[model samples]
Target: MPRRVLPLTDVQIRNAKPREKTYSLTDGHGLYIEIMPSGSKLWRMKFPQRGRGDNRLSFGAYPVVTLQEAREKRLATQRLLLQGIDPGRYRDDKKRLAAEKGSNTFEKVAREWHGNKVPTWSERTATNTLRRLELDIFPEIGRLPIHEVRHRDLIDALRKIESRGAHEVAHRIMAVCKQIFSYGIQIGLLERNIAADMKDVLKTVRPSHFAAIDTDELPDFLAALRRNESRMLKPTLICLRLMMLIFVRTSELIETPWSEIDLEKGEWVIPWQRMKRGKLTVNPDTTNHHVCLSRQALALLRELHAITGGGTYLFPNQRDHKKPLSNNAILKSLERMGYKGKMTGHGFRALAMTTIKERLGYRHEVIDRQLAHAPPDKLSSAYDRAQYLAERKVMMQAWADYLDSL
Candidate 1:
């Protein structure tokens, strides 16, 4: 026989007194109110589980939760149980989701993602990435809950940037936001990457290559460089000539630490960390890029060492010896020499590649290897770093001699 417990009334609950021990007043269907010895009242529920003893759940303290509200909670919990869901677990998940939503703001999650990526990025890249977010993005949707940020919200923010005529900047910011959204998904704070499909949404920006001059123009360019040398700083002049000799990227050249050089061996082994695509600071399988120094290059380095020998960087900033020269310094120097739109520091790479192939008759692969570019065949990307080492040494010296001949 089942026992029938009458439904509780507000008056009955108000008149109830606490006993020496806790006592429960049932309103049936597993819902009841417990009167504690301390005179505090709480609502509780008991439900049956198939292979286990009955489980109980708390509906919070009474007076805060009225009888009607407690009944509503009881009905909701009963529905979960009927669907084979555990009410306690459901409630816990609900609480966890609410806490996550409150804590994972877009800015907070983006900053966390940025921190996790700092190790893989150059110091300049890391700084510029965060600065772009702070200046352009955070002010727009920084405080929004990450999960709640929709596609339209992201487009609206990116559109605002595009409207400013900074199409490249807008594109870069959108890419960064997409990465952040993916990170949010990885961390369980977001469900979808809303910014994934926005690749062509912004204005179409024509790809621009670094300005380079044809090999025949090298003679005139050299003449201009010589005429402008008196107006250029001594270090800047040396940097320009070294750039033409080595033909490395401006960042790689300007940021060179003296320790990376081996004047005794006539080699400069740039560690993988300094390489643009370095995935790790210390990698065993991926050897560093070796620049074979020519007689011309060695002489210039000796001249540079006389000035900056005691410093850390080969091209230390004029005002701050401890810091490297600005990446823009070479560009500014070239612009001053009247080569603003025609040539760039990066243009030297193109110039060297073409002249060596045409004049010195070196294979493209050998020249590309010296240029520190991956092999064209995807499978051969991990080829030995010393592949064609002897040929590359000969090619580098020949290229330097060709440049001096001009």
Candidate 2:
């Protein structure tokens, strides 16, 4: 007959001491506290192997892997043993499966790929890319294994996006799919990029131009913007004026932090971190954009500073001082001024680009560089940054004075 074993209590386990030789205090049915000469106590379980000799598994050290938890592990191991499985091997297999699941899921790989790819991407591009991937890609196939993704699965998702009048978004999604699959191949997770075969899988899209005010309408529009009483926030009105003077994208204007400006230097330096141009993240120092401040622009900044100087942002959110002004604030303000369809917030760039070239007679390269049009390559782009600083500063003052003259 087999000997009956008793379970170990906490007191018994705690009272255990070490000696020169290692020894064990058995709890019951294979669970014991093994006391080492170094005064370390480890909880170990000894069980019979499947139709073979004895096998042992470490539950963990005492106190850290507590008495109750150790017993639970022992019970779980015994359950596996009853099924004629090796408890250690079963646990190891489970661990392997978990690790594989962690590294092989589409979300995991996609995030990893994004991290690798965005070192050079502008803050906007980086943010938008991740946001789109999370919203569109992650929901559909992010949980599945990368290898399990099929062309049809992607086509279906793209089709749904296209159905909602987002043909361009669908194309971008397909491109992301191809890139991710290619990355997976490099990492040995996929054999071939199924996304490579996804051309003509989405609807063709036409380029849409942002509605801009005609160059001839500047006087009326500026007058309308200055007197617009519908906009509740004074800062919103000032922001619209600044956008016209600086002619930056609405995003660049609204998101401007006070640190980026230099009222004394007569310059507002839009850090590479703020601009929509990509590759600034990789080499941030090379892309800081310079906007020469005219006296009128400076006057506006000084006025705005008095109101918002306490906060980090030039146009801090009314409710939350930490955040910048909302993107919609400018658009809605335009809408309120009855320029909703006639002139969007982005229209300022087009207006400035055209007028700076035709009316101001500045070089196209100078105007384009000031407008922050991204160059063809990152190296060329970085080289192009502030190349015409002296010329641009002159152009900036002229443009501002011209606005004042009108």
Candidate 3:
């Protein structure tokens, strides 16, 4: 049998004085307030653990937690006990989950993901990726607990980017966020990737190729480029000419370190790490991309070297020579040359591929190897293992001679 303890009144609680030793005043059941010698009152509960024994839980302090709130909490804890749950353990688990959610914010997880992937990415790639997230995605939902973030929240964030007419950027940011969430799930910070299904909801970005001029447009394009040379920086002018001659990817051209170029040997050995899909080697013999610089290209390099020879990048940024030129530098220069919408920095690759194949009379395989096109089938894969060094060296010189003739 249990003794009948009367529920305490607010009046009695307020008037209660602390004794020499800490003491409790019960409000029936197991709910009570402990008064310390320092006159601080704390709410607490005592409950049986069925098979284990009794355990106590501190609800909170007096006035702040209040009498009514403590009763509600005691009832909740007792309810859990009746259902064979440990109130203290349940409370601890909830608190732990809350703390974890606070620490596992979207921004925190995203930064962690970025840090982990930075080693594998180039300096330019790493910088742009983090800057994109910081400017776009982080501003919207970066503070939200990743686990609490739903697909709708993500859609809302992406909608803001779409509102700005950055459809392609929106698509890219969504992909980055998907990878971020996937990484969260991988490390047990989240149970699911909230951003997985968001792609279908975003605006459909139509596939578009890099804008390039046909072979016949080369003369007019060259004339415009020469005319714009006075308005452009000397390095930019030289870079454009080299791009025309080499026709490598814009990134490959702009990010070229001087060490990669051997002017005397007339070769530019772009390391495998610098190339796109570089993991898939061009041939079994080597992974480094070897470019045979034609005499015209070498002359241009020597001329540019006299000006920017001491610096790292051949096409160092005009404002900051310590770094490579901005990715937009070439495109903006092309735009200045009055070829906006008609030609892109990337367009040179297409123009060269077309001209070299049609005009040079080179076989498909030979030109394709020069272009570093990924192997399509196992047969081509085997073909990829062939460096075609001797033929490629001759072909590259001919290509340059042909461009000079143009």
Q: Evaluated with lDDT, which candidate comes out highest?
A: 1
- TM-score-wise, the better of 2 and 3 is 3
RMSD of each: 6.0, 13.3, 4.9
lDDT of each: 0.87, 0.83, 0.84
For model 3 the local lDDT of residue 94 reads: 91
lDDT of 3: 0.84
Per-residue lDDT tens digits for candidate 2, residues 1-406, read 9777787889988888889999998878799989999989999989887567887888889889999999899889888878877887888988896677556988889999999978666666789989998888889988889888888888887788889998889888888888889998898777889889876777777788999987889888988876785655778878888888888888788888888888788678877666665344443444677777777889999999999987899999888999989888888888888888888878998999988888888888888888888766777676665377778777888999999898
Order of candidate numbers by TM-score, starting with the best: 3, 1, 2
TM-score of 2: 0.66
Question: Which tens-of-lDDT digit does each residue in 1-406 have in candidate 3?
Answer: 9889999888888888988999999997889999999999999998887677888999989889988999999989878978888888898999997899788999999999999988777666789899998998788889998888888888988888889999999899899999999998998878888788764888799989999999899889888887887898888888888888888888888889899988877778888777777643243333567776778889999999998889999888878989899879888888888888998888888998898889888788877777767657657655554657678778878988877676
lDDT of 1 by residue, 345-365 (tens): 899999889988897899989
The numbered model that scores best in TM-score is: 3
Q: How many clashing pairs in candidate 3?
A: 0
